[model samples]
Target: MDVAVAGGQTATTSHQLDPLQRGLLTVFRSLPRTAESVPGRPTPLVLDVGDVVVLVSGTDRGSPATRDAVLDLATDAGVVVLDDLPGRTPTGRVSLVLATHHTAATAAQHVAVRCRAPVLLPDGRCVTPGPLRLWVRPEPTLTLTRPDGRQDVVLHDLHLRDVADPDDEHPAVVDVFAHPSGSGLLLGMTDGGAGATVALSTGPRCVRVPAPTTATLDGVTRTIAPGTYRIDLAHPPLYRLHAESAARPETG
Candidate 1:
C-alpha cells in the first residue's frame, strides 16, 4: 500500500499538526511503500498492484497519466485513492474518495459527491463526511476448449464454478461451464469440433457435430449450445463439464 497527498503538502506530514491533521496518513505511513508527488502535466503513469496512488491538486489540472493510472489500478487491484483534485468524481472504476478545497471557484466547478458508503472529504478547513457514489462492475470470463482442439476462444463467466468430477483413470482432463437453457454460447475450438462423449456427475452427455443439440434432463428437453455457457445456478455445490478420457474437453 502507498499514500499520495495532492495539495503539495498536508497536515498529515506536519509535526506541528494534531492527530486529526494526519487523517489516513497515520495509517498509511505504517505500510512499507514508496511515495510520489504528481506534477501538473500529462506524464506516463506506470503502476503495480496494491499501490496507493494519490493526487493533491485542487486546481493545476495535474498529470492525466496519474489520473488514468489511479482509476486503472482501482479497477484491476482495488487500490486506495485519496484525492483532493479539482475535478468531477472521475467516472468509472470503483473505490474512490474525492475531496476538493472549499473555494468559490471549486464550489462552482464541482458537483455534490454521492457515495453508497460513507466517505470523508476535505473542505479547506476540515475533513467531513459527504454524499458520494461507489461504482462496482464484476464482469468475468472463462475459456472452453472444443473437441477438435483447432480454435480457442473466451466466453463470459457470469456464475460460480462449484461442480467437480475427479477421474483417477484419465488424469488429463478439463472442465467447462454451461446452462440448460438455449443461450447459443459457443465453446472455443483448438482445431476441430468433432463429436465426443463427455462425462458429467449427472450423467454422460453426447457432443454431436454442428451442435446446439437437445438433451432431456428429468424429462425436460433443453437446447445445449455449442459454446461455453454460464449456468444460472442457484445452489453452492453444482456440476462442471468434465471429460472421461485423456483428451480434455476444455483448455481454460
Candidate 2:
C-alpha cells in the first residue's frame, strides 16, 4: 500500500514517532512510503491523490490554507488519514479522527484530544503490538495419527501478553509450558518465590490451584500422573489447552 507521511515536526525518521504512532503504522505491513519535498515539511505532499496519509505534526506549523488543503485531500480522494494535527474536522472519510480543543472550538466540529491509548482506526478497531508472535506462536503443527483417526498438533507460545510488562517482579513472569492429554492438562511450570497460585477462569467459574503447597513435577526423568496438579497464579493469562466437558463435545 502507498502511504504518505507529512509534517513530522522535527522527526528525521520514522523512529522519532511516539509509541502510539509507531504501533498504529504496524497495521500496514511493508508499506511503500511517499516522501515529502523537505524533511518535516507538509508541502510537496507526495501523496498519490488517494493514498493513505499519516500527518504527524500539529496544525499550527502549517498555514491555515495548507491545513485546509490537507483536510480537502482527505475528503476528495477518499483518503484514510491518521491526523495528529489538531485543526481539521474530518467528515465522511474512514479516518480515526482526533482533534484538539482549539480546532474543535474554532470549527465547532473538529474536536480532538491527545490519545493516551494507541490510536484506533476510524472503524473503531486498534492493532495489537505483538503481531508476529501472535501469528506464529499459536499456530499448531499437525500430526496425523492414523487413517480415519484424529491428528495431534503441537503449538508453542500459544498464550502471550499484548505488550511486554516492564515490571520484572510480576508473578506471572516465569517460564511455563502447557500441553493437553486425553485425560487432563499438563504444565511444565517453574519460578515464583514459592511457586504460584494460579487462577483459571472458564466462563463464570474460577478455580484456584493447590491450597498452600506448590505442585511440582518430579524430575526431568519423571512425569507426574496426569491430573495430579495445581494452577499457578504467579504467571498470568495462563491458557487452558483442553476444554471442559461442557465446552467440548464428542466429535464425529
Top TM-score hit: 1
- The digit string of per-residue lDDT tens for model 1 on 183-235 reads 23322222223532322223222233233544332233445445333222221
lDDT of candidate 2 over 1-252, digit per residue (tens):
112422221112133333333332333221213544556543321334465444443344322333344455456445655554434333433222222222222121112111111112211022232222111011111121212332212222112111112333343444344443332333344453576334333221112221222222211122222111222221111121110111224799
Q: Indicate which candidate wins on lDDT.
A: 1
What's the residue-level lDDT of 181 in candidate 1?
Answer: 21
RMSD of each: 20.6, 21.5
> Which residue segments of model 1 deviate by more than 4 Å?
1-12, 16-19, 27-87, 98-117, 121-252
| Model 2 misplacement above 4 A | 1-13, 28-88, 98-252
Residue 247 deviation, candidate 2, in Å? 23
Give lDDT per model, in order.
0.29, 0.28
TM for every model, in the order presented, reads 0.21, 0.19
